[model samples]
Target chain A: MSGTDKILLVDDEADFVSALSERIAHRGLAVDVADNGLKALDLAGQNAYDAVILDLAMPEMDGIETLKRLLDLNPDLQVILLTGRATLQQGVEAMKLGAMDVLEKPARLDLLLDKIRKAQANRVLLVEKRNEEKIRKIVDNKAW
Target chain B: MPWSPDPRWRDSDLAFFGAVTAGATHELNNVFSIIEQTAGLLEDWCADPEADVPAGCDKILNVTERIARQVQRGTELVRRLNGFAHSADEPCCNQEMNDLLENLLALMERFAAQRRVRLVFEPAGAPVTLTTRPFILEQAVFLAVSAALAGTAAQGIVTVQLTGGGAGVEITITGAPALPEAELPAAVGAWLGPPLWNLEGRVRTAARAGKYAIVLTIPKISEEVP
Candidate 1:
């Protein structure tokens, strides 16, 4: 399952998450499932995932908290929050908390996949930019 | 001039609007998600050209067309919800009774579906137009329909009829449990009365032939009342 399309899926609803993961896996994309935010955090820490499909409402740790922790561990990680019912306030809060974007649950798989692909592309760009900065700083120090 | 604004009701109205709109968007999100997954599956199949191209491509195309159909359904739902939100923009305006029923009913469909109630609207005559507070009128209609849905038996039908009556068009919601005037909530009667009165209309809840009906009479206004 370790491939360019590797992704983490976190949701408490066993049936929904399992079904969605199966569908995503059928698309030739690698999927790792986590039933709760804490487990998602643990997985994020141990393994490398390009993007995380996270649910907002959870038992202990909510999506926002999980999002902050995942990003803290890997700043380049793309997190998309899945909401059952979206209110105007929740959208703003999600963005402020450093979420890539929020998609309502049972979101069109095509759209969700598009967002994931975009997230992967963005992570690559950020990594490349950071490397460029680091190389420039090293070259400057050597010149000095 | 007859209509007076109640600052308290505004909160309740806003809350109701938020709830209905939230429910609509939530449902739409699920709809879009399903279509997205369907399209993704097609893309996966198309990415692999090694399979039997002619036969496999034909099956993939069928799924692709299904995605297009879902897009159409999602578009209509968004358009109807947009119209519903706009009904609250103006304090008072000229509105078509059927259009109002259509818009409001579309918003309430998910809620009604949960209770297993069917909402149907019958246009009694031509398009009936009246000058009134659109949002207030919508709230009145919403309450009446909700009550009917709540009071009726499971798998019941609430029929809303739009017809010309005494001074203006009469919007009748029938097929709910009947309640006498004494049984009516004084707060409801008090709250819904002023807006209709200001619009030169009236709302009456009466029992006829064993079933209860909420009759809203709106008198046509030739000039703006402000």
Candidate 2:
């Protein structure tokens, strides 16, 4: 498994989550499933997933709240939101909250796969930048 | 008292109209999402090897059927919504009771289903056509239904029965209680003003078999809009 290609699929619909994860797995990517936001947070904390595919509406924690918590736990994590009933205002609000993107439901699998690959690349870049900053700081401190 | 426009009532009515449209659009969005996912699945199955995917074509066929069904449902909803929007285009127009209520009820199906209430429409006789302010009259009836729903038990039935006689149409709503006399003023406030009163010849409430009933008598519009 390419470490950066792992994804967490969070949605209340069990069948939809199963079908979608199967598609993602068929594409040669590792996927974890979470039926609700609470379970999603658990999976995120336990594994280093490259991104999350989250549904906007749920029973306990809605997409916006879950998105907030997910980013708080991993500032660099990429999150793509899915919504069956999305409005322009909701999309704008989600973007302002640092989501990688908002995709209306029944998103094309190929397009979603493409987005996942892009998110994986962006995460790798962020990690490399952070590592470079840390190394430079260490060298400067040592010299001082 | 002379007729005067009530801004608050207008605002609330507009808000109700907005909610109705929003509900229809949300349903369409879900339909589109299902179609997208199904088509994507079909493509995935088709892309794989024919030998390994004997059922691929069959699955695509099934998905296409499902998509067609969704499109039909979405089209019907859009058509009903279009009918409702046009109901307001003119101040006064001729309306058939059955046709008007069917479209309005289609728009209201979600609200009723959400509350687990079964809506029943009973036409006593032949189609009754009346000339009136179609939108206002429909709004008044819809609000009465909403009011009755407030007192209705979940899974209970709300019946809108239509009858015609002597140059007028009588709509009797039974199942849930009518808005109390004290609250009727606010519920029908602006819509029941002088101009509307002329359209609704009579309004009253009565109890039938321990169930509340609200009756609205609609008079035929005398003059056509120029």
Reference-based lDDT, each prediction: 0.73, 0.75
Interface RMSD of 2: 4.0
lDDT by residue for model 2 (B38-157), tens: 566666776876434574577556657877877897799899999999998988877788888878877876666545678888875777777888887777677666656655667689
| Chain A TM-score values for every predicted structure, listed in order | 0.92, 0.95
User: What local lDDT does model 2 show for residue B49?
Assistant: 69
TM-score (C-alpha, index-matched) for candidate 2: 0.63
Q: A70-100 in candidate 1: lDDT tens per residue?
A: 9899888889988776566887888887889
* Cα RMSD for predicted model 1: 11.2
Residue B190, model 1, lDDT: 62
lDDT of 1 by residue, B152-174 (tens): 65567889988883347888888
